[model samples]
Target: MGKKQRRMEVFDARARYYPSAKLTLEELSYWIAFSRVMGIGPVRFQLLLDHFQEDVASAWHAPSYELTRIGLDQRTVDSFISQRANIDPAHELKRLDRLRIQVITWKDACYPPLLRKIDYAPPVLYACGQLTEDDLHYSIGIVGTRKMSSYGRQVTEHFTKELVKGKITIVSGLALGVDTVAHNTALDNGGRTIAVLACGLDTIYPPSNYHLAKHIVDSGQGVLLSSFPLGIKPEAGNFPARNHIISGLSLGILVTEAPPKSGALITANSALVQGREVYAVPSSIFSNSGAGVNKLIRDGAHPVTEVSDILEHLNIHTVPLPDTSVLREPENEEERLVLALLSREPRHIDDLIRDTELAPNIVTSTLTILELDGLVKQVGSMQYVRCT
Candidate 1:
């Protein structure tokens, strides 16, 4: 299909999903205009809304004195006035429409629920793909060092795959290393992911991930989310704010791997401040890549050894459909013993060994048999669960 046709379809889909009654298109244009002003952020934006009785168009046209009366400093008022003169609100909205981007304001019912609870959540979001209900509710933020070790890569893949199996959506920054692995694993497993960008959706930073970003949107399984306005470039200062959104959208933040100085720690910290759970993989004490996660665990972050650690703590219960074509009863006591220990919650092999008191070989062999009979499934590294 032609690019224009695809854009038209996306626009139509957005209209269907986000029909606005409280904020008309004209009012939204003013919101977009204010978002573009340099000095106005969520707090100031809210002040304007409250002072103007939620009429953003009125706020936009308010004189400098009125802006000052609403508590905007003289510098901010000057910036707003200077920018507002050059910014045509209608043209800004038209530009977004032309770019196939959808504007999600704080007033929209379709705004992410978790994000709305944050202290200073963005007043506006520019999204490039569909944001589903699943993305809003069942999301886990995966972040780690950009320079990942081989161990980091393996750990990220394992947790991501298991989370996807549990029907959880992955949220990440779309940076290299752990974020990339989490996004790709979720997609490969036929699950959804959300890529939160520091820059505007118009520009995919790190440029290398551009194709990955395209695939995410084109596959219809994920979204490209950003709070920055159109034409904004990726800046170093933008990342800390970007990290906040990643954690805000997720039920918890998981640090699969990271060094002590990794930016991923910033995200974990944000998760804590947001009153969200923080999960970290325990790595070797001697490994430099493990220092941040180890510190997190020491500071009371949940240490994840298996997928069940997250699922159980978060109270997320996922039951995969049984493979009807291969249903069979356990033919032996060993198979029955292993099957008895397995439930919808993933159990590590070591835990089963201790509980079953069976020989390691016996437990392994019995699990193999049960899996072949479609009675049990492995959700992660050496973690098994009942099929039903």
Candidate 2:
């Protein structure tokens, strides 16, 4: 049998196993399947949804004449009609479930509200890790060339560290160079980060960043996100599409360094088109890699000399102040108990555990949090004291 006929057989088989007649998952499967169709992209997908009263399953079965009448070109309609038979929504759902990936449709409550506001918002998001309320904070995008200069590297790290410290969630493409620096810096500083990928969640592109991707997932402080279907390869063309999601997720895009006509410049332009703020770091006028930054500054992109430049431009106040005076309050009974046990004079862990009648692990964990908050200090092995 030909590929087209084989697809038809698969679809017929999958239809028998479609989960009941419910409108949620079954409906979602149609959307996922439609996204996998060769010629249907964001705009056409929306057209299909609207033409079918938001019922993607019904839209999937819509006749080619109806699809063309609803605005898809004849070629696109023909492609969808043929490919719809080949796609198996059930198999897609099963694969995603087995891999533990979460598919967030536009209708899902946890979909990033800021990203949904864009005109070209993705209808679905494929995430390898969790998305939480904390991720919705004022987010920033950091982009630059894969080949970065020393100056570019320093600026990316400095600004990303400060932004993460201020509780701003960092968003990036998970590409090499500036994006890698941004995500790693955020994780290192105990801040949230989100990486938008140009490929599918099941495959990590650049191959070398598998460990980095794993760290993002395991950290629980960040997520790896994509709109591509399972097993999609990272093609050169996919990146421009990826750029839109990066800019859409962020409140602003920062171009740390780029030469003229770079992909980072494309993201900055997309941010402007999306009405998000764009910031660029100024570099030496003589540097070829700095050319894009200079032009962006000339064209009215905010020139960032410090992290405060971004804060001031965004009108964000109440940044988390890190100091001895600003230590966080004890979060639970265990933390309070640990703090109560500490004195100006160092006390051994064994003494605290015995005096408070707390378990060793609890005491150790509490002391670690207290030390991180700067409310306590370790003067020696297993010996801790309250910091004045």
Candidate 3:
């Protein structure tokens, strides 16, 4: 099939599954076209709909002066009028069929219900994975900083593992540090994870996680998700919007570690605005990594001292860790020493070296093998933590 035809197939699939709006073929196109225009966000789009009574194509053709009467700014009203003739809503409608990617609009019943309550929910969302009502009803939002302390890493892994045991789908921006830790840890625990991106699904930010994204989708254990169309690139400002989406779809938000001004903090704030629960894992007051979490706790966010701290808050059962089993084979002498140094919290590598009485190179070598086998994870060059 041609790209256009495939795109239509996706739209058809979504139309079949969607449960809202008596959208005719024309209505979906008008809604999608409005969402694509710059300077016309969800709020302004609503004004247009209110006046046109959801006759989107008619709204698009309404006089510019009439739009202004409804209080659209002069520039935006003019912009809309000027773009109407050139913007091809039909092309986008056709492209959805061409790409073979499913499209779910506000009219669709399969649209994530939690997300609909957000302030600026997208008019249309594209899906690559199978998203059922069950997954939507059981998502847990996990977020953290791109640079993490050993303690932060441990907390994220521990909480994510517990969420997995509760049959919850983990959601996070696929950033480095805590986000990566959350997704991988959930997968490690035999659970599914969903990655919300700041860019299009066609583009992977922090390219290192590309393999992990593939791994999630390939395993039937998780999915890759995004709101941007196929061609958009990640801009710095896209992250805050991404944060809203993360908190929007989830039942709650957990901050494993972050600086006070970090994007994770923004997510917590958005969660609050969205009426979702916010949880934080306290870190050392001395470490900058823990400063955001500490502040969150001070501001009345719940504290998570252990996995159960969060599970208990959500009224979930925490699964006990398996008794330490013998490794299929030891990776190296350092594996023995590094393993000895590990506990529930991640320790700095220097701390590990001092405690293990091993050479740095040997310790590093062993940690690498342990990481590959999913038995251990390196939180820092000098520190390692067993997968929580």
| Winning model by TM-score | 1
User: What TM-score, to 2 decimals, does candidate 1 have?
Assistant: 0.80
Candidate 2 per-residue lDDT, tens place, 324-369, comes to: 2455778899988888877755688999999889999988888888
lDDT of 1 at 42: 89
Name the runs in model 1 displaced over 4 angstroms.
1-17, 318-388
Off by over 4 Å in 3: 1-21, 315-342, 345-388
Per-residue error (Å), model 2, residue 325: 11
TM-score of each: 0.80, 0.76, 0.78
Give the top-scoring candidate (lDDT). 1
User: Model 1: per-residue lDDT, tens digit, 174-259?
Assistant: 99889998999899989899999988777777777877888888888888889998777777899999999999999999999999
Q: Rank the candidates by lDDT, best first.
A: 1, 2, 3
Estimate the overall C-alpha local distance difference test score of candidate 3.
Answer: 0.75
lDDT of 3 by residue, 1-388 (tens): 1111111112112222243467876777777677667778778888887888878888877898888998899999888877777778878767655644456777777788989988898777765555766467778889988988667777787778767777788999988899999999999899878888877665677677877776776666776667776655778787888888899989889998989888899999999999889998888889897799899999999887655566567664434432344555554666766786786665787777678888877666677778888777766655566763
What's the lDDT for residue 206 in model 3? 69
Worst 10 residues of 1 by lDDT: 1-10
